[model samples]
Target chain A: MAAPVRNHVWVGTETGILKGINLVKKQAANYTDVSSVTRDQEVNAMCWGDPQESEILMGCKDGTVKVYSAEKSKFTEFHDCRGGEGVFRGLGVVDNAIITCVESGLLKVWQEGASDSLELQVGAGVQKMRHCDAHRQKVGTGGKENDLKIWDLQKPEEPIFRAKNLRNDWLDLRVPVWIRDLDFIPDSDKIVTCTSYHQIRVYDPSSPQRRPVLEAMYGEDPLTALSITPDGRSVVVGNSHGNIAVIDLRKGSVLCTLKGCAGSPRSIQCHKSMPLVASCGLDRFLRVHHLNDKELLHKVYLKSRLNSLLLTSRDKWEEEERVAPVDQDVKDEEDEVWDGMETVEEKTATKRQAVTREPDADGVVKVPSSKKQKKKKKVA
Target chain B: MPHIIYSAWGSTCPAARPPGSVNNSCKYSDAPAEGHGAPGPSLEQDVLLPPTFSVSEIKNKQRHHYMFLKLKQDRRREKLALKKKRKKERVALGDKAPPKPVPKTIENQREHDETTETDEFAPYFNKQTTPKILITTSDRPRGRTVKFTEQLSSIIPNSQVYYRRGLALKKIIPQCIARDFTDLIVLNEDRKVPNGLILSHLPDGPTAHFKMSNVRLRKEMKRKGKDPTEHQPEVILNNFTTRLGHSIGRMFASLVPHEPQFTGRQVATFHNQWDYIFFRFHRYLFKSEKRVGIQELGPRFTLKLRSLQKGTFDSKYGEYEWVHKRHEMDTSRRKFHL
Candidate 1:
């Protein structure tokens, strides 16, 4: 009965600490330590690796990264990614490897279970460098340098399968570029790659040169976050604005636009079996949304803004609950205690500050926040 | 709506490694480790569209939290009511409390003086060799298969399989020994049975999994006061497996221990990218002290197996990658590490 539960959302914050939102009881728990701390700079980008223990690996702003253990009620720093300059804003997780977007337009891949004794090994950057979505053979992710490059652990420098074609599209003829936010469709042969200026092009992994089986242009808005459904039927993209847009993958059209998020959603993630969509942004709210119904599932706002999110399943949470003091929800009841006071005014004012930094940069119109921020409102 | 929130406070399912179990990747994992030598470097970037992320891909996860919240509230409310009742009794009786609700009330309501419902002389005798015990035992599956037939055929002493069928009353065992068996199921369903075998109609995969060896079903005569074969369905017994450890359930009956398990053909069709799992299990005996484990069968052992044609039940079929998905009762037990 020691398995990890899918009950809470893990949050990577600016302070290099791992924060969590218990979906069950609605509470905020923090894991903070700096022994093998990844980054000391403002935690820029983060993506939670699959739950190894109670910890999730995170890429940071300081050209560094690290693994933070959520198992420790107190944050226990696990690893310090010393491999390369940390991720600028993007992170891709496969099995134990953390593929992050480094500043040099290069991808840094790191493995979990690495004996992170030193900070070098902890947030050790780019152990095996490779391309994203090489595993997802469906969609094409344009190429690097003049051709698509995939690094195989088989041969770290070279790709298992590189460019299937050597043709240029309209944009390539205009301005050549590198790929960002690349993902493969689950159980399919589709691959998705997002680039600067909100341009997302898809290619069949089997045939890289063929026209994208699906393509969507987000105009000038850069895709802030990207995630695929477990079934790979849909996709969600978040931008500078506090909005998340859902799109149908098969048809490649906008399904719905949700505007309730209070801050710029940095990263959005969906857990395996449990229906949970986690998003974190400058707003400091770790919000969990139900994917099936597109409803707010849970929110745990912390003192610092959230940059990345991860989670284990329900059963793992149950094990921790026994060791916990009380129900996490009971803690949420504190919301009522501060009603009708100066604290409320100060909170609203802080949100106003957050709103300035988070405007709708993507094509999605920001949804009204009056009712959308309910889960987050009760928290902070 | 009944919502179950995965509580941060709840416990995980009982887990065990079954000796050499490999922690499987999520079913939907792209780089499925299904016995892949190891993950290849994914840094090869051929630009394409990443799958679109949608809100529906993550909706209604609130049930997990609510489940935990409601459970705790229920427990808290119950505790308060118990305290209130104790206080009320203490105040009224001056420290001497009355007994609580009647114990085993269901037992008192179970008696019936009805006479034996059916006659033994009828073709479908309704009374047993002993007095009508009304014992409750679990039912064997109505779906019979080749494995069941083979097992049943073997369970019976081959020489004495049809003592009653041949009308040899002298060989009848007079006693109905209940100790050797955990449950006795007698199914008389309208199944597409073979010419003479009762288990002939069952699905091959599971019937083999059920360990029906040394079992037999035959038509017998009603003694002067015994023989309870009836035409009606009744649950004579129940012995549902309990969770002792992780996967204890599947070691005996679980064919998909952690397999999105690909048949070699499926693997080849998917170019071995579909992932593969070799199905294997250890058989079980009711009283065996050592639990049947999966490790001995071989963990992560890939059988370059191919897929069988659809709906083809060649009982002695060999298309499956692994035949050892099942174990026989006579399998020699060996020592292994957990």
Candidate 2:
């Protein structure tokens, strides 16, 4: 049960099972009871409940948002939100309230213990909705034929920034609008989106122009998921054909393509600080790639098709290894006792040797003995 | 002259030469060359000859062929003598002889895949629903493709064969679901030969697209049995052990009826070897308790999986569970996915 604290990634599978993967230990454990869950409860979207990331809000296909507390290693609560016709496209938490958006374009904010919740229709065919981490009241929604729109939760009457469709092509035919995934660029009002038409667009809400300021195309297949890098200089986007590439925001050129993805990637998320990105998809494997070296650091097969994944925001992974040994000490008292006895035996042996040689060389023995004591204290 | 003859004889019969003696001969040969007094003529001739000698180095065509034949015969004789000695030793030991070593194969040395759990085929094995398959060919399928599809429909019980007529698969899927079709099989033809097959399970799906080749219809197969009867044929799936393999095996299993009529004595086998699936139809007759005679029924072909999608046939939008990337997945000959 203590292993959940060290899990670096949480994956939601099509089989309705949530798995916590510990890359350091090379182990993955199912957090949900496999026997009790059905396919209808398949996890569609997942998000952190708070800035601390101690709780995970998982939106299931059956129109229920289940809150899982990482500290408790179990589900803390379940909220029913069944007004939409399709599965949830996004989930977010702001000020203890849960924000959920379904594919049918029904976006709702359920306040804590409230019977009547705030509901709004952003548009039909909502493919993705993302809540801005910097601005708690701001959320972005986009979908098939639905342009990118950022709405302020406080005033749900109208959208704050609505993206305009691109101009007609060379033949004067209208370009289709299908935004598969979007993310708000941290430290700014710019929203980066990847479309099913294999286009990546960056929208600036502060500017007067409603059209995207920058547009880039990666591959022939439709882009399914994208996550902005922590530095906000590049965005990692994966298409429906198992190809993942990092696109530079400034120049709109591909930086590098991450290899070893055999199926379409369903979800991709970059670490908050470290140059690491974790992605999982229909390939049934969660792969963590280093953003700089483009090296595959870890790959774990979760046995089922993964729908979404959430990577922990906690940095300093080496610090966790030091803390893990202390947790093990509480479980194995006999091993701790043996370790303590061995250290005491070594100390007494050194003291006896110093005493035996003290008479022959008093000043020299004292110098080495004092140094040994300091070294022993540091070891303890 | 004697040293030159000895070195040449040593090169001809490698087994006669003692270990580490090639260096010794080279050392001995170098001493005479440095001295250059008694055997000057022989030394000059030896220098012209190669240090290492083989039959292929012979200059005359007739002599080269004769020497090569003799060398091969010597090697074969030595191998046979060694085998005979081992057989004699084994016979002397009798019951105490060690067990024979198992031969290594690519399949035996294959890398173990982690995801080998097999619970996805529960519905098919449990016999919850009977198979109702709809078989169709590509638009304006040629004579050979039409014949292959017709034979495929006859092998599976309760299946209907329909003309494609340029109808879109996306549109036909919903109509098939409404009519309670459990599975849909589409044969794609190029140049009048069936080259592709798409098998999509109805309602909710796990569609599999395969590259099909080597089609042999009933008329083409020699000594073929009569056309397959309407009785349900038993399905036999071989070597489908991995997780992805199990899913494919289940897809094939769900295409036929649950129970087989023993009276028909027919069998449809999907045999997998090196990731290539060979489909065969056969009719058997039990002559006695010890003997059974089998006859081949028509329309045999091979299939190699291209991709397995999670949902129905939406190539542009569907998520693929496993896709065969030639450069990535096919790195090792010993590693197999199915």
Candidate 3:
């Protein structure tokens, strides 16, 4: 029986191209646009519509949301998000609604009919919006001059948590506010945000202070994207200089850096069960690395700069292991002594040539010794 | 009168009776003047007269409200009289012209369907001459602009260069049009750096404007030794700022022939043209770090379509013609002001 195929890592490119890589086979498939018009070709954001990740929700620069189904290998539906300004900065799926956010901080939750039932203004110039399935109803938003805000879509009249700006420095100067990417700590009220100032801050809503409880600085370059590891104790972050590293959540220390990336990373995602991390960026390469020792597992050159990616839950290595066939007609003959083979014609012919290594000085028929063979070769 | 005055002062005022009334004795105990060390020797029978201003006439002091009301009523009456006079005049004049009864249609009278209207310069299409482009920049062109124009002329076959110093666009455009120039490419400067570009086709036009940023030259490119002019360089237009911009950029890039060929003894090589056409097309997240870094979407190649036009673009021209075809493909022509 053939091995069951695992999940495919999907990447959305700036050219509105969708590329899927099957890690087991190390194969890539490209999906082109159905129309010749290039307006809707720049894919700005992407999200999985279903829990099993069979449906992909792609947001284009033209404010159109395209639903592509992996099962059918074609786009299932296209819905225009009318009045949505600027490129889509975030795309998410919550229950029966398709949630989208633009750079102008217009967040809309669309039902099946594409009518926005719940809409919100997260303030203008929003850079990133993050929604975790674990906390299905809540989302986090932040950007320039816009502090981190956590809102419950079900009750969005007021944010559930609003972060305050950190206190002025010792010299009494205002601190800059630019939150690039954020993630909700699984099963907890804690949130981690990586900023353009190269700072990773952890905010606990349950705490007394409204500011981040733990603050630590990473590299000098601004961080662009981050994803929480499976265990939820560490976060893997990627910066504008194509530097990706893991940080310990408890101590906020740099754990290890993953190498071989050159341009700014656009997205970083870690699988829920596997020790694999998938990242893609302006370098136009999709890279998967093992979290254990940071060994680069697979690298695929996508034709365009990638904006976002989705790592499905299925493990290809496990399926490959299970389907690896076994050979049975083998014999262990390396150390076998064949005494009956000496009388065989073919065996004696080969043995006589091998045994006639050097003629002795006395012309006596004796087995060739190491010293005598060396001495005979020297004399010749 | 004094008793009436005391009663009118109300019970809350201990001074209502001038400290002579026994009924107010308890309220006067806290008075510091008569208590402790101060001596109060003089006691005179003082008579309080009526106040100079009448207390019951505050309502009479508010005269401005009624005056304003009267003024408003007078203005309304005057306006009504003027309107009646105007109406009478209009009725008398109605028989003469009737004001070209407003052209009733779906569109406003001022806005002709500009995209669908046929341009006046269609006769130039039959000439079959290669496009002659005039490349120039704003007054006092920067060093970068001059260098870019030199590089640009070498890419596009018969393009010429000029500086708009001490000359207006109105003067230059007409002169170029009269001189048989097919198109004009203008680089606008901000702080002595080229930041915006305008490409207008000759005579009549569907001009395109683009925001140019992150200008990198061949010397700035990472890979060296490969002459930028050697190969027919592939153009990459990365991350256009708008959807319409993306569509227009793609339309422009598609004009270049896929394979270069020599029609006679001449072969035109498009070299550093891609660099000028492919400006950094990205939205900066923070204004402070503007143009420092980019979230490059992907490589996108763009060309100035107007600068390549042989004849004026008419939306009502041939169906297969790019002018009308692109106008149809891009539904948001209103945004790009096409």
Candidate 4:
């Protein structure tokens, strides 16, 4: 298996910059998009291109799918998947095909060696297309005023599951539909969705009830992003107001709020094994929050407004600490050498002034013995 | 004789003087050749002495004074009788003291008192009508600071962001207020990390300064593996850690958007160095048992602050509007800014 990817949060920014943030090291490494020499393209969406999670499939605003290789530390391939109407909303890699979904709801599957891509219509106004790694063949699609539908890639005909709107409100008013973000619960047929109306709803397709099995509300601002906690019993959701809260699915109540995020949070992802959730947003900040106690672990400023981020499982900084002793000694020696150079410059300047002053003394300056004797007599 | 006496009294009373005689005399005087002798009193004399009475020259002064006293006594008696009658009527009606003239200020004070009394009991009632806020961090904030700023913004209703690195709190306060921002939060950073925060409420302000330490995020905490289904119990926030903290918390709580949009599923969260104040709200839900239940969800966290200061922000002493006051009070009068 490809060496387990190092533990880092990969972030895509609006300015087409990709950043790998080392949480343990508390540092961010930036990579510029070299595809266009003229102007930078907006990185709209990104997904792991291969099962090894070494290649990042980047969906650009300009209808291009560029695969950035983490091993090579550069973009390896570029494919043009022309969006007919709106910009790309989602991007993913299913086996050898690059799956891309645009805002206009055109889902295209591009084969690795093929010039032309296979197309499928996912209805109109698709906001997000989510691929479930647990069930590799399933992808979820939803948007504003659109029903949340899950589709099987193997059979592109009908949706495996589609969420039904809850019964009419008390006054018989039709509830408006606005699905912001959703995630499929691992090992279950349940899907948890956070809405723009500040709601968290969990729908179980296995059950006969069309309405959500559990629904809870978080903050006063519409929830823009959400991620299932490592335990899968809770979900961490962020709103347009930049508030992040962990809501318990069973009780439908907020467990705690993880504070210290400003600006609207765009995306949130919880690590599968660690009690950590990484979030990024318009504030251009990548924040890692501990799940159980709601404490912020590490914060990296990426400089540009971050739209989405992915976190790896392994910790790279932990390995660096094991090999830091020799590197520290070398760095210390270099530091001393740099310090010695500053002292050398000062010593040379003093000598040059002494040499100039000696010329003014003329013939008397040639008698160094008499000059030193005179100076000693004056001191006495 | 009665009619003659009445006419004599009318002529003597200057206020009751007939207009015809004055006009006739004026007309005759204008034709001086024909009417040099046609006046009872010359117009010139009338002009000089004006026929108006001085207080001392009035013949009915004593009588007028006596009549005034009599009328005053009668009015007093009538008023007393009316008051007694009203009192009797009120007693018959089983009413309390008569209504007094309540000034607008007193009315406002009483109205405020009633609302506050209600708020003391049911703080969750109608919480949506709070002011919208705008939260920003001090210039060149680190990632953690921006995240904190966003967290603050999310906890308040209708709040938006104005992100300019290293923005002066004084400059942004007025601009945010002009934009209808009810509150302005400025996260102050030291050595590129947030260590202080200033919550300046817009328009009228009691800008709160809090020294932040042990700055921790959720990720920094060790997992306790607490019961997932234990539903974090409801906290009774009737009393706060400090009086000032209570007011600040109330002030922050009062900024939630009124008439919450159920479809949008909004939430408000407030967190400082110590405590986390959360306002989780779901719109109307209809069920059989409760019929209609509105869930106001949030869990409280501890918050700590150095001091609670009021008034506008200023560069000197790092406070505004209170510059003159601070200068008068401070003996050293040194300039300080954050």
Candidate 5:
């Protein structure tokens, strides 16, 4: 007998259970549970990975990020962003941290499981971060300030590198122009960030002072989401008007627009395994498309906007949301792995502002701020 | 306690790190508002907000139901429309002007045999003296293994006496390949075999071997048997010419009975159960290609015996049945609903 093809289609809907579709035989007779996500909470984003790892993760409208072990039909309560599962519209898996693009204008990250003894490694509140320009070796943090600060674990508080905002080269910093979506070119050192007012700027982070390599006009609407082929040849953008356009990066031209797709697409992901693309829209439609052939694979109707999705596969990554305060009382133990790690240096340095108060009865540390305040008052 | 947790991820690369967290420095933690207490006031303030928006939710529910109903209706309409279109195409095929409706040729339509109108079997000669002989092909023509032909022929001698009902392609293609094949071998004879069901498998070869095994509801016709009037089996085999170009699955051969006593039911049952073993052909059409065929009933054969095994499930058993197996033969076109 010939070998049967190994492929299955997993779909998430707003109501009922998730469905598994077998395309080879044109069969639509299988169903899985997304309710393990949240009872009546609209599934916002879904990412597929290995099935055995039960690594399928779903973000629901209830403000909860639920990581499900679909193989064993189990789920771990990952995080609650808003309240239940807040209005999550964007989801991306970069490097095991799940990157969520929410309506809060704040980017949040999550990881797999509980850390060793609840020693706080990192906190949330991820800001303007992009892996742009000649590919990102490190993450860039953007604030209301005029400079783009790039951070490395070796030095956490201060940026290892910074870029001045040419548009606002003044004494004071300007509020950022609301960056909406970013796409990293596969196997290259380039990233594209689509901002409000229909502007997609291609930047090479390695060259901080330079202008964008290629700037494309997206017309007059804000993009809700974007995706890039792993080869970095084509870019697909989904806009707020429920419009989806595929752009050939090499030619920098719009290849084509999908029709009969009615809704404002909030987020979209291009599947690497096949010529398929998935997008979520305000029309409550999660449409899977065949990118190369421009055929609609399937449209899963949801009750709310789809934010992110990961397909099925093997070892899974879950966003580590919360950890207890690190026990500062532990005696210096050489075997403690965190003592030798780079993040330890970075995390402690970021917490240095409070280090000024925590001396632990050792004169080795001194807080100078209180003395400075006393001298200023005496002068006044 | 020594902990050995087997962590698995849904990725092809088992050892690779998770996506999105390049630095793996995801800070920020949110835990359930630890009971009410805070700035002296607890974090449970969100609980005081109206539990879910009833009005907005009601409106959304109505809209969702509307769309669901609409989609269901659209699917139903699509299926009905496709079925109707297919039915129309099949029906149109039978009405096309057929080539040389043998019974309605200009000459045959003009000629009149008033004297033969008395007996249904009376036409050319006296039926009383000539005991009608039925011809049955021995399931082999040419190119067949001699042993096969002999084994089959030995089972019923006088092989040429049986009526055959198939076309030979390899021998007939050179004479007619471009012409639209329309002529069929029809025996308008009052043979000992019932006229209601005339079956044959002519021009036999090993490759042309087919087994007729199923039973069907056979229609029977009658004629006045007492008349000693002029009547005989009209031999339709004129020059024994093949009209079609080539055969893919349906071969060109004739089938009949060795003896003349075969009834209408027997002939129809054999015709219904007929099977020609061959390889199945798979065809696909390009989007840009123009198709000339309007309606088609293509039956492909298969030599892969494994394909003949029973399906993963049996409908009657209502569950998995792994033991009993069956061959996947053609002719079961309607056995499983599309």
Candidate 6:
């Protein structure tokens, strides 16, 4: 197995295979034993276990959370949380405790070496649950007919904020509520969400109004996944038709649409600081696109339908290039030879500078000599 | 000045030859080369002819028709002479002639798809399970669709046809799973014509939706064979090279019984060309050591895949493995998905 530091993206597939992709090397490797895996163990959600990203916690379809250690390149632990009725929708970690939410809306917090776990029922038909990066204890839950609700882990009895449904439409019929995915905007109290009805909405919990402050529509198909940009001014949303568009959060307008995806995207995640976004889905290909130019940078066929993806927060890609090559001493020796040759060029350059300065000094002396001769002629 | 006149004359030579002689354009092109090689009488003729001359520019229709007929007759004579020369050359080198070159086709020059490994059909290929298929149609299917399903059920072994009765597929899936059916097929109709097909593998699925067209019933065929037997038929899958193509081929393979009964001498073929799946059924007979014959068992149709979903029959919420986006995917004529 290659070093986990070299892999920039980790994808969970429907065939119960975990794939690690290195964009710089243009190689993808399956991290799981394909022969031993069954369809019942399909990976549904994944998240970094720690701030250093050395551990990954994957939630599977059979109500098991498996922890993969990047340093060891293998799975180190598995915890069976089987009270939920459906597959897990989200996974998170806070202070060495694991947070898991399932489709049937069973949210649980399991502490290390503890027999009893803190469980909460957010609602039924939960589509997604996302942890807020700005606050450790904050998490949001939403789904079909289930409005957005932010829960504080410390106070599990009541939600901190509950989003109200939109007003009746022009036909006087009730508007439907189906939140497919959501992410909390860093440095603010705003939570942005994409709905199954192709609507992107941002709600301000700090404001008195419980309704969404902004709403925008992209395409006609249902929006399946979304991720906030690093700057948090825009959000990237992918629909069921394999169309991904970056929409502005402030003015509620589309910025640009990313192309080259053939099937519906299951998961999309933007890089922490780079102008790049990685998405994988039913097409079985992991594609990385530049958010600024929307150019497809890398595409890797992982040979299975991808369910979720996790992009490494590491920003130093060139550092991995220097560490990847095994022949370090050979490179150092080559550098020494080049360094020795550079001094010879420096010596010739100094000699040429000295020769050029002597001519400038002679020209200065000749001008004064000519002036003196002209002065002598005027005196005569 | 001569170069300019030469180019103008070269452009006008083909149009000046005749109408309905497009295939003889190669022979006419050689005329300019012969003129350049032997420039005695041909040069004088070229100088006399107008540069912008064309048969369409003729003012009189009768004279134009007469010239066209004469040119056609002359080209036919030249073609016959060339064929005679080629036949004589072949006869001279009868035993030592080089093999004829093979023709190129879109299938032979197809772009390589990277995903061709076989993985998903292990259970079916391992002979662990027998095929039990349930064929149904869209709610309230009309004349042609009813007949088509009846013929399809007769062709496939251990299959039964049921009326939809307007039940939701999501509801029907659970009942079908409890009954231990291996596959579920639903035929869709539009304006009393069977136009769509949805094939979903049972228990765990990778459902495929196809656009169905050109359905011909047994009675409609000109000289079809008699009604098929109850015995299992041999299956033939052709040109399924790509990864998606392999998946589709496996799906079709699982539709029939694993063990073929050769005593029946019946075959069902699914041939893929230009991404369209052509299905044919036939009955074969061995006449002698070197002689064989085949009769068509009718109810043949063509299918083009529209979308393949990961799970069973949940179009609204299920994820698609591949979807045919006409404007985006069909940009190239040579590129094929299946």
Q: Each prediction's DockQ?
A: 0.00, 0.24, 0.01, 0.01, 0.01, 0.17
**Clash counts for the predictions, in order:** 105, 0, 6, 58, 99, 0
Residue runs of model 2 more than 4 Å from their true location after superposition? A2-4, A323-380, B1-126
Worst 10 residues of 4 chain A by lDDT: A359-368
Top DockQ prediction, candidate number: 2
**What root-mean-square deviation over C-alphas does model 5 reach?**
35.3
Report how far off residue B332 is in candidate 3 (Å): 50
After superposition, the stretches of candidate 6 with alpha carbons farther than 4 Å from their true spots are A1-4, A80-82, A170-173, A323-380, B1-129, B139-142, B164-175, B178-180
Model 1 docking grade = incorrect
Candidate structures ordered by lDDT, highest first: 2, 6, 3, 4, 1, 5
Report the C-alpha lDDT of model 5 over A1-380, residue by residue, as the tens digit.
Answer: 01121124454555424444333333443234432333356665666433232356566666766665543444544665552122555444444655554543344454455332111112123223443324323444432222334444334445555443436437666535545666667666566666554656666666654456666756455665678864578788865545577877766678876643454565677755345576765455557676766767566554433334444221000101111125332322433543544554454333333433432322221212244345434544
Displacement of the residue B110 alpha carbon in candidate 1, Å: 80
- Candidate 2 on A161-260: residue-level lDDT in tens? 9999989999999999999999999998899999998999999999999999999999888898999998899999999879999999999999999998
Clashing pairs in model 6? Answer: none
Candidate 6, after superposition: displacement of residue A123 in Å? 2.1
Could you give candidate 6's per-residue lDDT for residues A223-254 as a string of tens digits?
A: 99999998899999998878889999989889
Q: Candidate 5: where are CA atoms >4 Å away?
A: A1-40, A48-54, A61-63, A76-176, A297-305, A311-380, B1-338
lDDT of 1 by residue, A55-143 (tens): 56566666555655443343344345544453444455666556554443344455667653211111122211223343521112232
Report clash pairs, candidate 3.
B236-B300, B236-B301, B237-B300, B237-B301, B238-B300, B239-B281
Show model 4 residue runs off by greater than 4 Å.
A1-7, A33-40, A315-317, A320-380, B1-338
The sequence of per-residue lDDT tens digits that candidate 4 reaches over residues B63-120 is: 5465445446655876787789988877877756577467677545753232132222
lDDT of candidate 3 over A1-380, digit per residue (tens): 02122246888877677778776546687765423435356788888988766788888888888888876677878988755578888889987688899999998888876543678999988989888678789899998889999999989899989999999999999999989899988878999999888899999998888999999888876888999998899999987656789999999999999976755688999987667799998657899887877988788887566889999874323322222112111211331233333344243234234333433113222122344335434544
